[model samples]
Target: TNASPSNTQTPEHSPTTIAVVKGLAWLFGSGSKTSTAIRETRTAYDLCAKRDNEESKFIHEVCRLSPTYQTWFQIANLHVWMVRTRYRALPAPYGKAFEQEFVNHFFLDIEDRMRAALNHKAPERIVKGYLTEMRDQWMGATFSFDLGLVGSDAELSGAIWRNLFASRGLDGKGELIGKPGKIGESRAVADGKAALAELPFHLYVFSAYIRRELKRLESISDEDVMAG
Candidate 1:
């Protein structure tokens, strides 16, 4: 009898072939997905940036976080995290797109700010390095808050301390913890100790703000959020 078809299976796909497949898959059907993500970014940017009055009030008035690029990043990161968490309720794909746009907007805004203020006329490479460091903080906040949200009240408070307070725990007696003498760095980190004195009040208000936003977002229809 003729031997059965060769028992050997076809060779595995080559790396190049796999990459081409992925590219084609994304390209062929990604137009709407891309549009969807872009819309999310723009709408969120408008709501988050243009309507930043409340956030600014708390950060400056209640929290008293010193005005600087890092503080700005922290505030932005906090709000963005709140909104991003809400999007997790969306169907996975859509939610993923929304979350991605949320972060992309954060970085994009930072890039613009860096060019105008931080790196001011510096080479692109210098700015990129700063941005890279920021990316670590961004990712760290994402997880720290995630744990805090699910963990104990103390956990949430700890996350806020580490992030919103620049990891300055209570051990330092309201200083930079490691003897952060002076504060020429970042416009005026010297204000940090002063701000830390208000940390208790800041933590209370900020934690409340987070809880309230979570509740408000729950009531909002997915479509309404997308509309914004």
Candidate 2:
């Protein structure tokens, strides 16, 4: 008797294939994603060669394609700083500044990693694997916008306390926790204000990265024109 097709078999999607599709979707979801990536790199390259804005340059260069992996390694150290500074008590202005810088650095690093994946000479499967890893890490508890330092219980507690105190305009000493009745009502307003400031920085960073990538693509297209 002829064997029948197995009805019990489930459809299989290879992880690598799924990853490539996901990465491509992420890459193309925005109209200017490629351009933003190029712009961020260009700015970093400009800053790096000039040796000015060294810290910003440092953050951007960490993920730049280069002979050394020092930049990548340095990026791996940023989460600690994110955790500590975000949790520490500071003046409102300083806290705002630190939060902006933290987000700026985060996107710069992410853009760099994505750029690396794009530049990798390995097979598409390997490239997609790298992108998939990024997606997985981001989807997990290690990263988030509302909460800084997602996985660390201590960091989370510290962030909550810091936010609570900051919302009340109190120093870490808790002096002003309940003094200002109008502002002491709720953290909701404070969080809303913070979100307004924080969200824009992230968008700016991502936009800059995409702009940079588009420029690179344009340059390559130009070269192709000249050669052709």
lDDT of each: 0.61, 0.34
Per-residue C-alpha lDDT of model 2 across residues 27-72, encoded as one tens digit per residue: 4342323343333433433332222124445333321112122223
Cα miss at 37, model 2 (Å)? 13
Q: Alpha-carbon error at 157 in model 1, in Å?
A: 1.2
The TM-scores, one per candidate, come to 0.73, 0.24
Output the lDDT of residue 215, model 1. Answer: 91
On residues 1-228, what C-alpha lDDT tens digit does candidate 1 reach at each position?
A: 111112323333333334433443453333345467777666776555532344666665555455555666676678888888887786656666666665555555655655555324565556656666666777799899999888876788788988877766455545333212111123233555676677777777677778888899989998776656
Off by over 4 Å in 1: 1-31, 50-57, 169-173, 176-197
